[model samples]
Target: MQNTTWGAIMGQPFGVIGYSNLGFVFDRDRIHEYQTYWPKEETGLARDVYIGFKYQCVEYARRFLTLKFKAAFTDIPHAHNIWALDIIEDCTKEEGTFPFVNYPNGSKEPPQFGDLIIYPYSKEQRFGHVGVILNVNLEEKYVDIGEQNYEEAGWECPEYARRLIMKIENGQYFITNKRIGKPYDNWDINEEIFGWKRIDFSQKQ
Candidate 1:
C-alpha cells in the first residue's frame, strides 16, 4: 500500500536487508526454510508448512519478494507474534454458498480487521490447505488477500492435477485452479485446523 520502509520491510522486497539491518538478519534462517518450498505447497512443517498464525501471517511477512526464496522469506520481521491475536469478523459472505463477494474500497469494503484466514476443512492431495487474506487489495485486484507464500500469495499453482486459488465458498473453504489446460474448481475440505484469517490491526479498537 504505502510501500514505506515499514511496509517494504514487512513484505519482503530485495536488497532490503543486510548485516547492518538487524531487523532483517534476525530471522534469516526462516528465509532459508521459506525458500526451500515457499510459493510452493511443497514447503511443509518439516517441509515449510508453518500452518499456524506464525506461518500464515507473521512468518509470511518475513518473506521478502525475490527470485531467491530466501530473499522472499526475509520480507518482514517480528510478525509471528504480532498478528496471532487479531480476528476479522466483518468479512462479507455470500448466500453462505459458492459465491465470490466483492470487496470495494475505503468504507465500502468489508471491515475485515485482520487477515481472513481460512483453514481447509478437507483435503484432496496437495490441494487441501489454508491461507490468509488480511485485507482487501482495493486499488488492484480488490481481491482480499494476505501473506501467500509460493507466488503472489501462491494462487496460481495447479496442484492435485488441476487446483488453484484457495477460497471459502458456501460455508466451506477449498482450493481450485486448473489441470491439463482446464478449469478445476471446488475441492471442499470441511475439516481442518490451524487455518486462520487476520483482522485489521489498524482498525481494531
Candidate 2:
C-alpha cells in the first residue's frame, strides 16, 4: 500500500484506505496482508514511544497525539483502558507529563477537536476501539472521526474516516454508534462510545 495523500477505495483488503485527519488509515480487514508488529524504528518514532499494534485503533490515537501534541500516554492493555489515564508524557521539551480529562459518554461537556474518542469492549470488538475526533458539528449533529482498524473501506471525506451521529439531550452529549452513510462497518448500539479524553494544555508549564 503506497503512502499517498489520498487512497483509492477499490475494495482491497489491507490496502491504504486513505489519510486521516492526522495519520494514514490502513485497511485492517485481512490479518495476513499486513504486519501487525510496528516497531518504533519501522514507524520512525522515538524509541521510548510505544504506540499500540500496527493499524489498530489505539495506534492511530497515540500516533495522532504524538504528531499533533508531541505527547502520548503510556502503553495501554486495550483501547477502553485509556479512560483510566490522567496524563500524557511529553515526547519533547521538558520531558514532563500533561494532565488530561475524561468525559463520559453522557457528559454535559461536549467533545472538542483532537480528542481521543474511545469505544467500549463488546462481542464485535474484543479489544475495544479508539479514534481522534476531527470535528464536532453540533448543528449537523455528527462528529467526524479518524481511525484505523474500525472499517475496511476508504474515507468518505478528505480529512475524516467516518461520521458518527451526535445528539444533545438536556445539555448532555452522546456519540451514538449509528452512522450517517458510507464505508459501512460493524458499529452498533452494543459498541457504545465510552467517552473522549482531552489534554489540558493549560497544565503545561
Candidate 3:
C-alpha cells in the first residue's frame, strides 16, 4: 500500500493540487471556502449548464459528466442529494433526459468506470461527498476515484486521487474506504458509502 501520509509544499496557492484525470483539477480547499449565495458571475458552467462550486467535490463530478459524457444535472442542494436524482440532462440532445440508476452499497451490481460515488451526510462531511470513479479493478480488488475537497494529498497515481478496497461476497459487491487494510480515505468511513449513480445511456436510444 502507498503511504497515506501527504506532504504539502509551502507557497502553494489555496492548496491547489494538479489535475485529476480528464483535465479536472482537485484542490485542498484549505481556506474552507463557502459561498451561500451563487452569483451568476461566479458560478462555473460548461455549455451554459451549471457545474456547482469552483473546487467542491460536486463541481468535479458534474464537470466530469459534462466534458466526458455530454451530460448535465440541475442544481442540487448538497452532494448527497445526487443519489435521489432519477434522471440526467442530456446536454447534446434537446429536451432530453437520461435515466440514472443507483446501486446502493453492497448491491449485487459492481460500480463501473464513470459512475458517481455518493456518500451520505456525516459529522465530518456535513454536505456529504461525491466522486467520479476512474477505474474499477476487480482483479486487483481496488477502485480508483477522482474528486476535490476530500483530501489535501497529491494524487497517489497519475489519474486518480486515491484508491479504495472492493470485495465481493455471496454475489454482492461491497466497498471499503480503506486501501489494503489501512485507512486511506480522509472522511469517516463509518458513515459508509450510499452507493453509486450511473447515467444509463443505453436507455437513451
- Provide the TM-score for each candidate, comma-separated: 0.27, 0.75, 0.75
The TM-score that candidate 3 achieves is: 0.75
Clashing residue pairs in candidate 2 are none
lDDT of 2 at 116: 84
Between prediction 1 and prediction 3, which has the larger lDDT? 3
- Can you write out model 2's per-residue Cα lDDT over 1-205, one digit (the tens) per residue? 4233332331221222223222445566854443333355654645457655655678667877776776888888888888888888866653688897899998999999888899878788798888788889999999988777665455655567678899899999999887887646464655778898999988973
Lowest lDDT 10-residue stretch of candidate 3? 7-16
Residue 98 lDDT in model 3?
93
Question: Quick one: ranking by lDDT, best first?
Answer: 2, 3, 1
TM-score: the better of candidates 1 and 2: 2
Report the lDDT tens digits of candidate 3 across residue range 1-205: 3333322221111232323222234456633343223333443422356666655678778877876787877789999999999999877755688998999989999999889999988888899999888889988888987776676545565457767889889988887787643345454556679988999998873
Q: How big is the RMSD of model 3?
A: 7.3
* Each prediction's whole-model lDDT (CA): 0.29, 0.71, 0.71
Quote the positional error of residue 85 for candidate 3 in Å. Answer: 0.4
